[model samples]
Target: MTDPDPFRVIFVCTGNICRSPMAEVVLRALAVQRGLASRVLSRSAGTGDWHLGERADERTLDCLTRRGYDGSAHRARQFSAASFAENDLIVALDRTHERILKAWARSDDDKGKVTLLRAFDPHASSMDVPDPYYAGPPMFDSVLAMIETATRGLFSQLEPAVRAPRTTLRALRRPDQEDLP
Candidate 1:
């Protein structure tokens, strides 16, 4: 069997303590459910280093856990030019983070790879995944709902690109009954 092509994705927020980490976990769960986990790699980072080396905010972990997602073993990290080169897609949690990524991008090609996480949501015109850290639990729930919807859309868009053409061709082949006899 041929090795599958891998697609890397990075989610970014201000501190990597809330929005981005949540997005990473939610998207990973969605990808696994859709059987794209092995074809895709997902991680999260902060636009700044404020929370580098620290776990996601307790509230974020609690919310994710309650929603049936594992939030363990996540440590905050900062976005870097290397990550831009490594990731096929760099998703920013808000406009500010998007702009920061664009500014840090090494080239036009890298800049083009950066996008707002909410871009997949037609209803979210601003393309910003609102920060729920300062809000109540309901806000976090809302963010998760948005992330789930967007992640599903993202997976659907990527499915065709990652599907193995050989598999499809094999499935389309039919046996000759006369030859079998």
Candidate 2:
């Protein structure tokens, strides 16, 4: 577990308005379905800030709404060095996002906390969730399907760790200090 708790997670992508926000809503919905909603706090941001303060892409909203997931309130934002401390897990939607996030990690432990979203998928074909912005409506649908499958797997992976009991808070071990455990 990391400070502020083990269940906080952030989804990452190239831009917040597309894949990452979609992922956030999908995972949040899954958390609710799995009875982990109150225990798991899900969020999202992007590697770039170009769309900051903007709503999620309309295509994404349509796909989520039509699929019974709520994504109406998302606003774009950029992932930053500060995010490393705020989230226990940083889930990158693609390999590129993972690399960008790793560059912000202050220590090896922070780097370790960052993982590709599809890594949770037991039978994933590709690790990257393709950006749907440039493509047509069908691509947005494809993104939704991919996010849904990955988030389900992610929820299962984290659920046990989240449900486990915890001791009193202790400051997270620094990179060098982790070897002592």
Candidate 3:
């Protein structure tokens, strides 16, 4: 099979302190659980730079910790055009983030990559994943739940593309084995 191309995904929100950071950790953990860590590169960012150098909110960290996710190393960062170029999918936590990303998008292709995170979930017909930063701990839990569900759906959509390259590589190797005989 041919070498697999890394599938890059960036989760975004208003400030990296809360939702985005949580999404990043959750998605990373999910990828690891599915044995897709080496096949995918998941990260997070914010539309604003308010917490650029700060760690995730204490409440968010605590919530994630309770769920067995480590958020100790999460440092907030802002999304950039460079990130858009690097990621295959740029998932926004809400419509506001989607707008910000769309505005910053350099081309039609870039805009196409930007989408609401909830849209990935077949159950989230509402299209918005409410921001939980201001609403406190319970809100964080709700956001986490939605993100977990969406990530599961996202993985389902991505599985085929992720495996295609590996399949091609195996096909190529089979021919090489025949020549060795």
Candidate 4:
């Protein structure tokens, strides 16, 4: 069986530079602050390779830094089958990434590993986190808010496994399931 502690999580989006990396850094910081750093591993990637080696967008970096989050060192990477094999959970930023990831699933279990990031948010206004790639700085800020909110909710759902490693992996619900933590 897979190790229950250090539950792995990868945030995925179309470009990796904006939404996914932001989620990754925020989740990592949140996990560290909440004392779940060692029990959770947060990371990110893009569905496409267009910006494979780029740093996050300048606006994203500015917003993170302004919020005192460390996202400066994030280097973009493309999501692959290996990413799925490595992480316990793969979180898609929006419906497009979700559909692409679902198409790339190698097994039922792998497909189950993939879920929408906002699915964890009890108060998410929409099923997808809107892409802020083309928007102004304000949009990035707004999306950052969404990312933080959803990360809190996601960690809440996963906290049981951190506290009691015996918590079954099956407790993590699919995006379609609405069970609250």
* Residue 57 lDDT in candidate 3: 95
lDDT of 3 at 3: 48
lDDT of 3 by residue, 5-81 (tens): 76888999998888888888987887788787888788899988888989999989988998899999999889987
Q: Could you estimate the TM-score for every candidate? A: 0.86, 0.87, 0.86, 0.91
TM-score comparison, 1 vs 4, better candidate: 4
Clashing pairs in 2: none
Candidate 2's TM-score: 0.87
Residue 159 alpha-carbon offset, candidate 3, angstroms:
2.1
Q: Please, what are the lDDT tens digits per residue for candidate 2 over residues 21-115?
A: 98899888877887768778899999998999999999999988889988889999999888998888899999998888888889998998888
Question: Where does candidate 1 clash, by residue pair?
Answer: none
2 or 3, greater by TM-score:
2
Question: Would you list the clashing residue pairs of candidate 3?
Answer: 1-169, 1-170, 2-169
TM-score of 3: 0.86
lDDT of 4 by residue, 8-64 (tens): 899999989999999999889978888878878899999889998899999999999
lDDT of 1 by residue, 68-122 (tens): 9997889999998899788888988888998889998879888878877777765
Candidate 4 scores a C-alpha RMSD against the true structure in Å of 3.0
Specify the poorest-scoring 10-residue window by lDDT in model 4: 166-175
Look at candidate 2 and tell me the lDDT of residue 164: 66
Q: Model 2 segments beyond 4 Å from truth? A: 1-6, 168-181
- The per-candidate count of clashes, in order, stands at 0, 0, 3, 0
Model 4 TM-score is: 0.91
Model 1, backbone clash pairs (residues 3+ apart or across chains), number: 0
